[model samples]
Target: MECVFCHIVRGEAAAHLVYEDRAVVAFLDARPLFEGHVLVVPREHLPTLTDLPPQLLGPYYAVVRRLAGAVQTAMGAEGSFVAANNRVSQSVPHFHTHVVPRRRKDGLRGFFWPRGRYPDAARAAEVARRVREVVSADGAG
Candidate 1:
């Protein structure tokens, strides 16, 4: 099907992966609105959640919950946001869930944005460090 996520699932492209199982794979977003943003997706490449098999529905939710927890812990954010897009908003044309860490004053009043850069490498490092810690600890099980 030539889906980008399918290639990601097959390890054809590089991704900062957080988790994976027989049916799904989770990885960091390359162009993150928030630093710890990650995408949880099925390996099968369904176009939307509704298109997923009944058997996959349970595991998908479980992965979402698990990824949210990991994102919060890793990014040291005040909270987390999880979203699934169905139609026009679905940028990648594949069924995926976004787990984004939310800070108290990130200026992101809503999901839409055109923001500035990290200013320096240190900020980016902080995000990466925390995400790595949380994902590593959580994935141990």
Candidate 2:
């Protein structure tokens, strides 16, 4: 109940709010990757992507898409990075998409680089099954 984003949505805390509507709110990130980095959050306090209702996805992503373009245009960057992290690296407990302006060699790294792999097909299938269970149980499969 003490989520920072929840406080922002309720206007209990100060935020440089840039956009808001019936479904979502967007604001400048206090700690940004760059000056124009923004966090677009749904008004409802869904903890992560899996918790977001399917019907709201379009509206949520519409804001993300708009923010991506706006961040790049407003910051005069060559491109933008639009991303979300779930429980692993999500600093806040609520769902939010990061729209960050980008330029060549701007120092953010690893999206294009290769990552560590699973040991083999059987091991991979086991992992896939685990993920599939969550998605399928949620009626998303």
> Model 2 off-target regions past 4 Å?
112-114, 118-138
TM-scores for candidates 1 onward, in order:
0.76, 0.84
Kindly give the number of clashing pairs for every candidate. Answer: 0, 0
How well is each residue in 11-126 modelled by candidate 1, as lDDT tens digits? 99999999999998999999988899999999997998779988999998899999999999999998898999997789998999999999888877876767688879999999
lDDT of each: 0.90, 0.93
Q: What is the model-wide C-alpha lDDT for candidate 2?
A: 0.93
Query: What is residue 96's positional error in candidate 2, in angstroms?
Result: 0.9
Best candidate, TM-score: 2
Clashing pairs in 2: none
